[model samples]
Target: MNILFIEDDRMNRRVVRDMLDVAGATMTEAESAEEGLQLIDTQDFDMILVDLRMPGMDGITAIGHIRAREDEKAKLPIIVVTADAAVDLRDRCIEAGADDVIFKPVAMDALFDAMGRLLARDSDGMLY
Candidate 1:
């Protein structure tokens, strides 16, 4: 699977990349939301994993930008990965067009579980 990972923190970026690699995702990472958006415009991904906080555009805004695009690209499954675990934060992410949300420091099991659900739903054409 292809994953677009947007994160600015170097250590967190390395950790998440390693975990996703171990999980069999071919990852394309960007240090900020602007870079990530540029990548999304030029390439395709099975899933988009974004950090809520960043130096430039935030994840919520980034997801909105992606969703505002055309066709299948606009409908891409976007998963917000963040340390902000508050229910209100999650609701805001979902409201901003994130297909799902995962909290950071990302638990491998939970992250993979969320990915499984999203991929399954995408493939089956049914909500997971």
Candidate 2:
């Protein structure tokens, strides 16, 4: 699968990239939300993992922009990969269009499981 990870921290991106590599998934790195949005216009990805906080645009705002797209890309599955543990974080992410929320430091199994579940959705957008 092709995954786009939008994170400002270099180490965080590298760690996720290595994990994705093990799953035979190609992860395209984006250092910021703006860069990720631009990439979305030029490429296709099976999933998107966005950091909650970044320089300039936040992950929630990015997801909103993606969901606001005029094309089919608006339905792209998104996951919020955040370190924050705000009680309402998950709700906020879902409200902003994320399919799921996974906290950091992320475990490989957790990441794989979230991806598998979201990608396994049926045509009606229900979990299968």
Candidate 3:
């Protein structure tokens, strides 16, 4: 599957990229929310993984912008990756249109499971 991963941290990006590579999934990395938004506009992806905290245009704002799109891409499955596990943050992400939230340091199995579930739901036409 084609996945877009938006993260500001180089190490985190490398780690997720390696994991996705080993899983035979293609990943495109974005260093910031602006870059991620631009990529979303110009590319097609099966899923999007966004980091919640960044220097500018945080993931929540990014998600809002994505959901604001009038195209079908607005409904693309979005997973928020965050180090902060605050309840309010999770709620905010969900309210902002994230399909799921995964905490860091992410476990490979959990990430895969979440991806699989979302992808399955999407393919089954159960996801919006």
Candidate 4:
């Protein structure tokens, strides 16, 4: 699967990249929300993992920009990979169009589980 990970921290990106490598998936890294958005415009991805905090734009706003797109790409699965522990973080992400939310210092299994769930569903929201 092709995945785009938008995170500012180089170490976090490295860790996730290693995890994706182990899963035999290809990952494209973006250091900021702006870069991630530009990547989205140019390439397609099976899934996106975004960090909540970034220099230019936050992950939630980025998801909103994606969901507002005038094409099928708007439906691309997105997972919020954040360190935020706010009481309403998950709710906020869902409201902003995230398919799932995974916490920072992510576990390999959790990442795979979330990806699997999203991949198993068709665009119509039915199991494939």
Give lDDT per model, in order: 0.87, 0.94, 0.92, 0.94
Per-residue alpha-carbon lDDT of candidate 3 for residues 14-35, written as tens digits (9 for 90 to 100): 9999899989999999999999
Question: In model 2, which runs have C-alpha deviations exceeding 4 angstroms?
Answer: none
Please give each candidate's TM-score: 0.92, 0.97, 0.93, 0.97
How many angstroms is residue 20 displaced in model 4 relative to the true structure, after the best TM-score fit?
Answer: 0.5
Error of 2 at 109 (Å): 0.9
Ordered by TM-score, highest first, the candidates read 2, 4, 3, 1
After superposition, the stretches of candidate 1 with alpha carbons farther than 4 Å from their true spots are 123-125
Model 3 misplacement above 4 A: 122-128
lDDT (tens digit, per residue) of candidate 2 on 1-128 = 89999999999999999999998999999999999999999999989999989989999999999999999889989999999999998999999999999989989999999999999997668988
Q: Estimate, for each residue in 36-116, the C-alpha lDDT of model 4 and write its tens digit.
A: 999999998989999999987999999999999998889999999998999999999999999999998899999999999
Alpha-carbon error at 116 in model 4, in Å?
A: 0.5
Sliding window of 10 residues with minimal summed lDDT for model 1: 119-128
lDDT, residue 114, candidate 3 = 86
